[model samples]
Target chain A: MRILEIENLKKSYTTPDGEILTVIDVPGFALESGEQIALSGESGSGKTTFLNLVAGILRPDGGRIFLGGEDVTALSEAARDRLRADKIGYIFQTFNLLQGYTALENVLLGMMFGKGADKGFALGLLERVGLGDRAGYKPSQLSVGQQQRVALARALANRPALVLADEPTGNLDPGTAGKAVSLIKEMCAESGAALLLVSHDDKVLGNFGGVKDLGEINRAPRGGIEK
Target chain B: MNRENVGGIFLIAKKSLAQHRLSTVITVLSVALAAGLVMAVFSIRDQTYDAFTGGPAGFDAVLGARGSQLQLVLNTVFHLETSPGNIPWEMYEAIKENPNVELAVPYAVGDNYRGYRIVGTERSLFTDLEYRKGRKLTLAEGELFNPEKREAVVGSYVADKTGLKAGSKFNPFHGLVFDERQKHAEEYTVTGVLEPTNSPSDRVIWIPIDEFYRISGHVLRGGGGTYEPRAGEEIPDRYKEVSAVMLKLRNPQAGFLLDQTINRQGTAATLAWPIGRVMAELFGKIGWVNNVLSLVAYLVVLVAAGSILASIYNTMNERRREFAILRALGARRGTVFAAIILESASIAAIGAALGYAVYALILAGAAVVIRAETGVVLDVLKPGPALLAAPLAMIALGILAGVIPALKAYSTDVASNLAPLS
Candidate 1:
C-alpha cells in the first residue's frame, strides 16, 4: 500500500554573493495509495522546494527517495525522468500550457511526451475533467478555473500513480477552489492515486487526511498563514 | 515512440505553426527568396550553354580564306556575323573530297533583308541539317528549288514577317555591308518555308550561290549589264568569292588535325573551331572576373547560413519556456535538442525549395528575354553539377543553424523550471 518514501532529504542553493543556502531537510516520510497529504508552510518555508525534490525535478545534496519501493534518488537524471514520466503527474498553480496550443492540444501535449497514451484517450481524459466541449479552445480562450481543469486533465491523462499538485487552486475563488479540490480528489481517489498537495491554504489543509507542517520541523515559522 | 505519438508531435508542430501565421509566412518567404536565387543562377548557366551549342547544326569546324578566326567561326557556326574573307567554292569541294571529312557544307553570307541575313548554300543543307526533335526542312506549301532554278528557301521568320512562303517571289537585297544595290537583277520564287529552328537559321533566306552572284554582279554594275571596276582599279578577290565553308569531320578529333593542316600547309586558308573561339572570347573577357564573382557568391551563401543561425539563436530565447514545459512533461534533454534541430532543418528545407523554384523562374524569364533581344537561344531546363550546389549547401547550413539551439535545449535545467517563475 505504501507508494512513496523519502529519508534524510536535503536541498541547497547558492546565493549571488557565494553564500550556500540550505533550504529543506525532511528526515523521513511515507505515503500509501489513495492517501491524500497536505504540506503546509508559511511564505519562503521551502514548500515548493520539497515538492520539486520529491518530483525528481531537483537533485537533493544528500537523500534517498523511494517511489513504489524503487530507489529513485540513486538513479541518473535521464532514468529519473523516465521514472517520473511513467509514474508521476504534476499540476502547477499557473496551468502552464504552451501558448499556441488549444486546451485539448495542451492535455494531449503531455501524452505526446509520455510512452503509450493515444490521442483518443487524451480527449477522453479532457471529457472526464468536464472540458470536452472546450477541447478546441486555447488556454487564452479559457477562464483561469477552466485552464486549471485542463492542467488537471493533462496531469491525470497518463493515469500516473502519484499526482503532485503545487497550490493548484491558489488563484481561484473559494467556490471554484472548493470545486477544483473536490474534483481533483475525486479523480485521484477514483484512480487510487496518492496525492501530495503543496499549499498554505488552511481550508485545503483541513480537507486532506494526512498533514505535515514545515514550521514544526524547521523550529521557526517564517510567516503566519491567513485565517 | 509509437506512430500515434509521432503523429501527435507533427500535429502539435503544424498547429502551432499555423497559429503563428505571420512568423511562418516570414520564414517561408525567406526560404523562397534563397531558392529563387539558386535556381536562377543554374537556369541561366544551362540555357546559355544550350542555345550556343544547339545553334550550330552538326558543323565540326569552319574553313575560310585567311582572315579573322573569330569572324569565320561567328559567320559559319553561329550565323551571327559576316566572314572577313571567302574560301572559294573550289576549296570547299576539295575539303568535301578528303577521306577524313564526313560531310562539308558551304555558306556565302553577304546580304541582309530588313536585318535578317540572306544565306547562299546547297540544297543538301535543307536535307542534311536537322533541328531539335530530329526534324528536317519541309515546305508548308510548294516544292523545293532546283539547282538551275532561281528559287529561295525562306525561313520561318521570313515567311511570317514578309508573307513570302513557298511560291511567293522577291528581288535580292543589295549588299552584305551596305544594303544598297543599284540594280536588282535576280528575282526568285519562294520554293520552301522552314519550320522554326529557334535559332539564327530561323531568320535566314537560303538561295543558290549562282543566283546570289547574278544579283551581286548586276547590282555592283551600277544600273547596267556590264560589271566594272572602280575607275581602272583592281577588284578584291574576296569580293568575287564565297564567304566560308562549314565542314563536318569523320571524327571530332579531325578538328584539331584540320586546324593544324591549314595553319601548317595552306597559304591562304585557315580553320576555325566555333567552341574554341567562343570560349576563348568568353574567358578572355570574364574568366578572371568569374573567379571574383564565384567567391562573392560563396560569401553570400555563408552569410545566408549565418543569418539562419542568428534567426534560430534569437528564437531560442522565446522557446525557453516551451522547452521547460516539455522537460516537465518528461522530455529528456536529448529529445528537446532533437526537436529544436528538427524545427531548424524543416525551415531550411522549405526555404531552399522555395528559393530554387524562384531561381528557375527567373532563369527561364532571362532566357526568353535574351533570345528575343539578342537572338541567343537558351534552354530553361538542363541538369548540371553547378545547379545542385545550392540546395546541398542550404541543407548543410540548416543543420549548422540547428547546432547551437540544440545544444542550448540539451543544457536546460528541469529543476529550475518546475516552480513557476516569479
Candidate 2:
C-alpha cells in the first residue's frame, strides 16, 4: 500500500514586485510503505516546500495529499497537525534538536504529542542510534555526526509510517555522512517506515533504493517564474 | 494530554529557564523584592493596629476634665501623654459610687522619676487593671504598693533602666524634668517591680493616691494658697484632686448613659469618653495614610508583573526558532503556548516563596526594634488576609504577563523558520 500519494499538488509565493511565484507544481507522486526513495534537487527548487506540504506545516495552494490512507488536504490545520504527529516523521538538515534538552529528551519529545509515549522505548531508540551512553549530553555537547544520529533516533521514536529527511547528511564529513545515511536507512527499514530522503549530493543519493529529481516532477519554473 | 507529556513539558520549561540563568535570576529577584516590600507593609500595619486597639483592654470609658477624649485615654491608659488637667477627687468618689460602674481606677499624675512618668493610684491598679485581654499586672520580683504608705511599684522598664529594686528609696521630681531643686521633699521606697506586659504600662512607677496628694507640688494651682500643705504637713481633704478615672462599666451599653450623667449631674462635672470609639476615630483620621501605603505596595507588584512581561517578551524573538522546531517535531501550537505561560508562572511562584522568606526576616528584625522602642510586642507570625492575597495576586499577574509572549510563540510559522535549512 502507498504510505504517501500526491495528486495535482500546487503552491505559490508572491514576490516584492507583486508577481505570483509558483514554488511547487507536481502532477502526481506516490511512495509505497517500507520503501526508501531519494529526492534530489538544486537550491530553491521547492524540495523543502514539498516536504513542508506533506508534513502539514504549510498549506498547499491546491492539491490532494494522502498519507497513511487519510486525505491530508481535506483535514483542518489542527486535524492535519494531529495526523502529522501520529503518522509522519521529519529530519531537518540542521538537526534542529532543542538546545535545552538532552539527547534522550529530544527523542522523548517526538513521542510527547502522541498517546502512550514510553521512556524505555525512547531509550531503546537512542541505544539503537549508538547514543545510549551520551543520552544525558545536550545537542551542543555532541559532534555534528552524533547530533544527526540523535535527530534520526528522535524521528523514528514515534514509530511513524513514513520519514522525510531533508539533507540528513549535509553537515557531516564524507565518512560520517555514509554512516549516518546507512543508520537512517537501516532504522527506517527496521521500523517498516518508508523513507523520502532529499539531497543535492549524488554520493548521498547513491545509497537509496530509488531516486526522483524535483526538477522533473515539479512543473514550476526553475526560478519560480512561468515558462 | 497524558502524564508523561505534562512532565515533559515541565522539564522543557525548567531546562529552558536554566539555559538563561542570568535573566531568570534577575526576573525572579525583581519579583521577590516587590513582594517583600508589600508583605512588610502589611505586617507593620497589622502590628500597629493591634498595638492601638489591644493596649487599652478592660477599660470601657475614661472620665477626666473636659478635654480631648483621645488625649485622656492616651494619658490614663497608655501613659503616652501628659494629663490634660485633673478632676476633683470628690468627682472620682462620686463616679466610683455609681450603680453602673464595675471598677473605677483613679490616677494622680504630676511627677516623674528620671523621665519615667510616676502614676499614683490605689493598689487596685495592679490587682484590677487589665492590659491585653484578661491579663492583669503581676510583680516580677517584688510586692504591690501599699495604699496607706509612701511605697512605689516600678514597672519593668523603669526597674531595668534604673536598677530599682524592692527597698530602694527615691525622691520624685516635681514635673517631667530632672532639676535637683525641684525634687519633692517626700520620699517613697520601691516595694515591687511588675512583670513586663509588653504595653506602655511597662514604663511607669506607681505610687499610692494618698501619698500623691501629700506631695508638696500636688496642690491644684487655682484652689487657693490655703490648700498648700507645708513639708511634712497634712493637706485638707478639699484640696485633693486626681488626674483621671478609668472606668470598666458593668454593662458596656450603660457607657452612654453614664457618660451623660457624668457631664450633666456630677458635683464637679467631667466627661466620660468611650475608649474604643475614641480610638476608632483616631484610626479613622490616619486610615488614609495606610491606604496610600497599601496602594504603593500593590503598585510595586504591578511593576513586578511588568518586569515579568518585559523579561519574557524581550527574549521572544530569540525563542521563535526554538518554538518552530518544537512545532516541526509534532508539538501542537497549544503546547508551545502553554510552555511559555507555564515558564512565567514558575518564575512567579519561586519569586513569591523567596519574597515571603525575606519578609519573615524583616519582621523578625522589626519586632525587636518595636518591642525595645515602644514596648509593644509584634507578633510576626500572625496571619492576615494579605498573607494569602499577595502571592496569589502575584501569580495571577504573572499569568497575565505571560499572555503576550505565549501568543507570539503560538503564531510562529514553522515552514518559514525551517526554510533556511533547505
Per-residue lDDT tens digits of candidate 2, residues B1-422?
55655765786678778987888899899888778778888988887676766534467888888777788877877777778888777778788998888888988887888878898889777787775566888998878887778899998888998989999999999885557778888889999999887777877899987788778766654253346545455655566777898887888667878776766665454554667678778888999999998999889899899999888888888888888888887777878888888989988988888889878877888877875555666776788876777888888899899999999999998887764734
Candidate 1 per-residue lDDT over residues B3-115, each given as its tens digit: 54455556544654565566656765665566556556555655555666544455667788787777777676666666676655557777889887876777777776655
lDDT per residue as tens, model 2, A64-84? 999988899999877877777
Chain B TM-score in candidate 1, rounded to 2 decimals? 0.79
Angstrom error at residue B409, model 1: 2.8
Docking class of 1: acceptable
lDDT (C-alpha) at residue B161 in model 2: 87
Interface RMSD of each: 5.2, 3.8
lDDT for each of the candidates?
0.71, 0.83
Error of 2 at B197 (Å): 3.4
Against the true structure, what is model 1's DockQ?
0.44
